[model samples]
Target: MSAPSHTTSYYAASANDKNLRPALQGQVEADICVIGAGYTGLSTALHLAESGFKVVVLEATRIGFGASGRNGGQIVHSYSRDIDFIEKHYGDKAGAEMGKMAFEGGKIIRRFVDQYNIQCDLKDGGIFAACNGKQMRELESKKALWETHGHNNLELLSDTDIQKYVGTTRYKGALLDKSGGHFHPLNLVLGEAAALESLGGVIYEDSPVTRVEEGAKAKVHTENGSVSANFVVVAGNAYLGGLIPKLQAKTMPCGTQVITTEPLSEAQQKALLPNGQCVEDCNYLLDYFRLSGDGRLIYGGGVTYGAREPDKIESLIVPKMLKTFPELKGVKIDYAWTGNFLLTLMRLPQFGRVSNNIYYAQGYSGHGVTCSHLAGKVLSDAIQGQAERYDVFAGLPQYPFPGGRTFRIPYTAMGAWYYTLRDKLGI
Candidate 1:
């Protein structure tokens, strides 16, 4: 198999450092073997390595090459399905347990950056912009709900108050979560990989796992080599492909587009985001934008349900950006790209065991940025004989899309269209 390079995007271009890790070459042994070098895998590897476990990580491409590297970089709290849904579906006790861990992902990310001194262009604060009164009410309700979970760093901004943070008239109000923020994602993941290596963990890039031979001891086979370990973790997410047939039906890959504009003048930057905080609207098919450390406007929106790329992503996204900030009609797009994120049928992440010794976690839906880091801790805990946190996710029911793999894309696409229309109508 050919080695893959990082996608052409702002994160790749501004990456603080690159890891030219060599591919797997021969048979190896470890206490644990991890597949994929994205946030979840690297986080799990780092945590376990710190716990004195001999771990090895294999990546099909570069570290953070998946959604971790290419996402909007907004580190929001909770899952895509929302805490209320969890309470209603799983009962009060389960929901409260989940809410307790909800804010920890961001904390873990901050701890990693501070502990390792990772230079990921970290920033502070994120806003949930509301486009209408209905959404504003929703934001208020969301703020209240989150506050009940002990998340106190939340502020509800009215239409008058929102303007100080964002330069857009499209939003009626906003919810400001000071704990939520943004960063240079690629650099952060790279930093984690380096930290793992420094802790005596081994990582091999461009070594895609062809298959996992499951048994008392799971053997992970790659194109050039194999790893026989007491435990195996599959963290490939949307890019896992057909390595495990059972996982394919449980998660579907969806694509989202993003574009970064040429650096704006200091005045223009202030006019757009005066506080330099990341902002994402309340719409289901939402628009998210923030200023790069260097002053470029990085905006992303629109979803392709089947993981299909638009021939001209810039054309598809620029109109949305201009609608939010019409003053940017003349801004040149410096980079445009799309990446896939795994979406479960219920919009919640799916976690379960493929075999007693073979564990997997994927389908973060659209909440991979922060949740993936949290998931790493959960996976590591489960592996280290601490199953309390992991079982919370594993116990949640994950169902296949209504129509299964063959028709799931079209089914979900129709649902997105309906919600997109509802968002437009402010319903």
Candidate 2:
């Protein structure tokens, strides 16, 4: 079957640029060959290209076809697991390093937007809405914890004060992170691919890798062609399937749905997100929403284990959106879509090597937006012999699901249910 097109999405409808990269049909060679054209692959290819390396990226589908194109577009800091958890599980030194680097992903994003002049409707300030007192206390602790890592651009908003940002009575409080924000995610990845091409990086869309031969030089076999490179970076993340058995065992694909309401009137937009900041509620199963450049309210929530998309994306999302903004009940939904995010057993990202020359980074566990970009930089650094920072993640322990691939869904779903129950009980 031919590779699919970009999924029907608000991002696809509003994307400013599109490119049809030819499929790889013959043997090609590069200093580095990257599998997957999402954020991690594109970022790694871009960084390598900027450093004057011969880089080639292979994408099974269109650019940003996965979560990169389908996400809520929120630029949140840190990994799927918080730094506090890292401090507890790892150590204070590792925790501090993780915290220091947590905010760097947002910085990398801002730098790319400014340097390349990528027009992705970049916005500043993101709010973490607390739905209850317990969440509020967590936000308070988060503020102090982040401050310890030199992140001082945080403000705690009381229940009434949160109304100045989000037009919702659902939150008890909020944490405003000036350093975090949102943008057009699909355009950001597309722009990064363009930047990579301008630096002489090659991209092959519709090229699916079938196998990888590892050694001093890695051979990546695609359907109709192959790429031989001094190093290989496997970055397919959630959609990788079983290309690598060990990786597939270590992660599960979790699907989430999103919907875009028809462009709201200026008044409606103002009344919704008055200060124009994106808001994500504090829930184990959270809801995130923000305004589009053209004024659509892009709201997303709900996770389906085992990669089963909800029967009705809108049915699953619209009600949740209404719960937060009942005023939008009369508005029609213009678009709805679903995308899978990779979830690791440990919640922390899995970064390690298959061989000395074959490196893979996956399991962002729904925190790929920023961390994927950070992963790209880290992979590039590791390839270029600057392995200090790379070791921070590569050295962390990554374990496969307890029941392996077959039963990980039920195991994880049960765990998520427990947390969801806790969120509901305000525990």
Candidate 3:
């Protein structure tokens, strides 16, 4: 088969990085070798490069080919599970450690953009719109909880106040996080990749790893070449496949579809989202929409429990868009696509070492954009002998789907069915 290129999303069409590096051929050596060139790999490599480590990146496909490039682009805070869940399950100390890191991802993103001069059209502000009274109360609780954790930039929005930010009535309330924001995700990753190269780091695209020969020195074998290094990082999220059988049963890939409307008039943009903040509604299977840098509205939702792509992307997402903004009834959809995010049974990301020196961080559920950046920093810290923060995530217990991989889809679908019913009934 031909080496994979990017999907036909808007980001791909507008991507600034078009240079394709040569695939690995002869064996090479580095201080650190990274597998997968999405946010996690690129971020980890960039951090190490800045610290004067000789880092090499191997990509199965193009950089950010996974959900990193094709996501909703919102820099949401926290994990898939909340701080309360972490505190309740892992104890207050763990929760406090996790809490302090909750908002670090967004900050890291801004620093990279500012320091590297990346042109990802970074914007500030994000919204968690509540669909009903119950969700509103949850938002109220969320604001209070997050405040206790030192995130005080939250403001609760009444039904009328929500209209000022988002021109919709579907939400009874909302929570505005000033520190949270959105941007062109693909460009951000590409910029970071370029930054890595600027610091003498190497990235080989189209070089998929076949296996890893473990021992005193870890050798990552690709189709045409291999890399011998002291350490290896597996940042391949959902598209990782079965290269490491041990991780096969630990995560499942779920597809979410996105659609972009043709450029709207300035008036229309104002009527839809006046402040131009990204909005994610409060629902079990929620909908998220944001204004693209080019003035088009990017909206997405609806999970395909399994990794299977749906037949009609526009049909699956457009109605949900209209439900939120009825005035956009006849708007033309410029682009429609789907991407997969790895989901863990516990909804927390799986972070740990594959072996003594092979590290990995995956399964961000629906919050890949922000958390993946955090993964890069924490993973790099471990390589630099600062494993305290990394240990916090690594120490979390990881479990496979109850019935294993084959049955995970059906099992998760049943649970989603329960919550979706609650969403519709507003219970």
Candidate 4:
């Protein structure tokens, strides 16, 4: 089969820098070898390199070429999974710890952007809007749970307050998080990658890991070359493919489609999002949107569990955008694209070792932007012989998709249909 093509999104056209790093050739050795130059791998490489470890990152494509670069750029404060779900499955102590991790994950992202002087258009306002009373109640419950853990940055907003911020009457209420915001996701990833290189880390783009030999020392194979390292970290997430058979079975691919409109007038931009806040409605399959630095409306929200791209992604997403802001009736969509992300059955990130020297992290379940950053830090710590944080995620049980590889597409489609129905029925 041929390799998958990159998404044709506005991000690609307006990328911060377009320098392509050469792929791996011949052979090399390092203290740590990371696969996938997306957020997880790049962050792991960056942190490990800063710690004085010789690190090399292998990317199937260029850095941020996957969901890391193409996502809606919302810096949400929690995982895609519900906190109640975590509490019910794991005990209170474990649940609370996971909650803390989710909360701290957002902080970790902001801290890195600040410390590294990353110019990713960082902002600090986000809202989880409620479209109905039920969602409002859910948001309130979430607020209480967060408050229980001393997370006071969350503010519950009424319909009136919500309107003031979002300039839309469709939402009944909202949960505003002052600590959460949005940014240029691709820029952030690239900045981190550059930072990693500055710390003497090596990065090889277009170097897909074809196989892994796990033991005390692991060897990661590419098409033309390989890296033999003391520790190997698999941060490929959705793009991992068959590198590790077990890891692939635990998560299925889901495609997310997005589009950006031609730059709106300054006045028009403000009228849509008054405070320049990033907003998403409270729903299982959610719509997330934010105004770009130059005023284009970057809107995203549809999910396809299948690996193939939808024949008409723009038509599928544009109507949804119009539903929210009918004011942009005649606006032209400048770009449309889709990216595949991994959705694990448990909704929690999957982290564990194929062997003592081979560690892997994936299944952020759409929370990869921030969680991957945290995953990188945690994975780096584990590589350095500290396993407390790593163990927390690795302890989470992961069930393989029931239908195996052949039936994964159909199974995911059926499951997505159920959620789509719920979202439509407002259940």
TM-scores of all models?
0.98, 0.98, 0.98, 0.96
lDDT of 1 by residue, 210-314 (tens): 989989999999999999999999999999998988889888899999999999999999999999999999999999999988999999988985443444898
Sort the candidates on lDDT, descending order. Answer: 3, 1, 2, 4
Q: Any residue pairs clashing in model 4, and if so which? A: none
- The window of 10 residues in a row where model 3 has the poorest summed lDDT is 305-314
> What lDDT does candidate 3 reach at residue 199?
97
lDDT of each: 0.91, 0.90, 0.92, 0.86
Shift in Å, residue 278, candidate 3: 0.6
Writing each residue's lDDT as its tens digit, candidate 3 over 1-427 gives: 7878998889998899988988999999999999999998998999999899999999998999999899999999999999999999999999999999998899889989999999999999999999999999999999999999999889999999999999988889999999889999999999999999999999999998999989889999998999999999999999999999878789999999999999999999999999999999989789999999989999999898543333388888888998989999999888888999999988999899988999999999998888899999999999999999999999899999988877998999999999999998989
- Model 4: CA > 4 A from native: 1-6, 307-311
Name the candidate, 3 or 4, with the larger lDDT value.
3
What is the lDDT for 370 in model 4? Answer: 81
Best candidate, lDDT: 3
Worst 10 residues of 2 by lDDT: 305-314
Put down candidate 2 lDDT per residue, 1-427, tens digits, no spaces.
6569987889998898876999999999999999999999998888888889999999998889998998999999988889999999999888987887898888888888888889999999899999999999999999998888888899999999999999989899999999889999999999998888888899999998999998778899998999999999999999888898888888889998888989999999999999899889889899999999999999998898633333488888889999999988888888888899999888999888988998999999888999999989999999999988889898788888886767888898898899999999999
Clashes of each: 0, 0, 0, 0
Model 4, 34: alpha-carbon shift in Å?
0.1
| Model 2 ranges with Cα > 4 A deviation | 306-311
